[model samples]
Target: MTSLFQFTGSELEAIKLSVGVAIYSSLISLPIALLLGYWLARKQFPGKAIIESLIHLPLVMPPVTTGYILLLVLGTRGFIGQWLYSTFGIKLAFTFEAAIIASVVVSFPLIVRSIRTAIEMVDPGLEDASRILGVGRLKTFFQITVPLAAPGIISGTILAFARSLGEFGATITFAGNIAGETQTLPLAVFAYMQVPGREIETLRLVVISVLISFVAMALSELYIRKMKRS
Candidate 1:
């Protein structure tokens, strides 16, 4: 096995890109996840089931199918894609941006589910008490509710990050496997596997992927336990 520090330039680039994409995707999904989670936990609305099912479609559907849907909606000739390109000269397909978007879409359901469970675990009585004490609804959410749900939120973020890191099919289908541009760690592993005698390189990337995901889950659990104790 190659030393962890002995990654080739391509491997290093893939690692860096994977981290960057995961971070961006997780951060970008956070606020939206928070809102959706809170709403789902506390509100009753029309089409609620539909909204939830749609949000979770990627989880149930094949990843490649999800990628194909994304391509049809965001490709260069797509409705939104055409407008975006024509107006802002931005092309989302087959780019780093697309990879991030794919990650966000695939990982969003997990994030929402985690945060919603956390929010539901919080006592409604506490929020009502705060409101009765003249705290605005928004303020109550930010102060009492969010802090109480912090563990869940943190875990959800970590889960989303890990999911993003390991994303493969959607990323490859939508972003293509362009090294140093859109190819992330998972993509690198897939690429290495296609070539003979690249077993060491492939194994190295696989180990790195496993290590990253394991570390993320471990940290999340550790922090959650600490939070609970506190």
Candidate 2:
């Protein structure tokens, strides 16, 4: 069994890239998700449906389309990308940054949904009571609402992080799956499957992915249960 197997260095590089991208994606997305989620949960305004639809669109749209849109907006020749590269020498397309963006966009809906649900679960009466006491909007949100929503935020973030970890289509389309550069765990497994003599290595990666996902779910459940108990 060992004789037939040879894991290329690229495979390891892909795993590392995946982990880094996932971590970056989670960090970058968390704040945006929280803000959007809180807004959706707490506020009502004109064109809210449009904003909500845009936020959740990636969940239904093909990942390829999502990636293409990101490319169009963040490509070197694209507006934002060109300005960023020109002003800061920062290029996003086909790089780790692109991967993080793609992963975040794809996984954002999950985090938003989780957090929105959490925020909605908070009693509005409590917010009103805070206001009656002259608590400012910002202070009330940070001191009361966010704390009440912490359990939800944490679970949502965990879910988002895990989903980002396994993102494939958007990541590959935007980042180009370059080994040690943009390639991630899923890309590595796909690359291994494309060639001969790497089945065992591919299986190992599959097991690792499954294990990680299982652990994430388990931890989310534990956290939620603890929150409930408290």
Candidate 3:
């Protein structure tokens, strides 16, 4: 039983790849999410509705469909992909990079929505006051709006990270779950479940996934509470 419980080299590699993909995806998504969220919260433009709809599209779209779209747009034979590969030797499909992109796409909406809500929570009067005090708009935003929204940003970032950690459908569809490459824990769990004698391994991975999610949520809650107190 102990021997069976032991993770093989491939399993270890899968775990590492999973963490790498999730971390990369979350970090890359954070700044973009912040900027878009701020824009959505603070600005009202003619095509704002269209942009907001696009940002929220992933929340409603099927993960598999999103993955397929990514493949179509970023595959080796894709127009953009062909240019990337030819000009810069970059290709995205069926690779860890693809997995990161899939994770980012799926997780982005949560971060954006969270931060947008936070931004809206900030009082516009504060900005008015700052402007009257001769503070530039950008300075007011960096000092007042952003700090006030810190808790929301933190919660949103954690949510995105957690979403990335658990992403499966988009990742597998776009990256093909190749071991030691694109296979994250969710993909590994699926693969293990399909094997003849890996139920325990699958269960273990499931437990780990649950634990990771639980921790992320707990941290978010803690931050939220602290923010409220502050």
Top model by lDDT, which number?
1
Tens-place lDDT per residue, model 1, 186-228, is 9999999999998889989898899999999999999999999
Which portions of model 3 show Cα errors greater than 4 Å?
1-5
Model 3 worst lDDT run, 10 consecutive residues: 1-10
**Could you tell me the lDDT of residue 206 within candidate 2?**
84
**lDDT of candidate 3 over 190-230, digit per residue (tens):** 99888898788887777778877898799889988988898
lDDT of 1 at 77: 90
Cα lDDT over the full model 3: 0.89
Estimated TM-score per prediction? Answer: 0.97, 0.92, 0.95
Q: Model 1: which residue pairs collide?
A: none
lDDT of 2: 0.87
Ordering by lDDT: 1, 3, 2
Could you tell which candidate, 1 or 3, scores higher by lDDT? 1
Q: What is every candidate's alpha-carbon RMSD to the true fold?
A: 1.1, 2.2, 1.5
Better of 2 and 3 by lDDT: 3
Residue 216, model 2, lDDT: 79
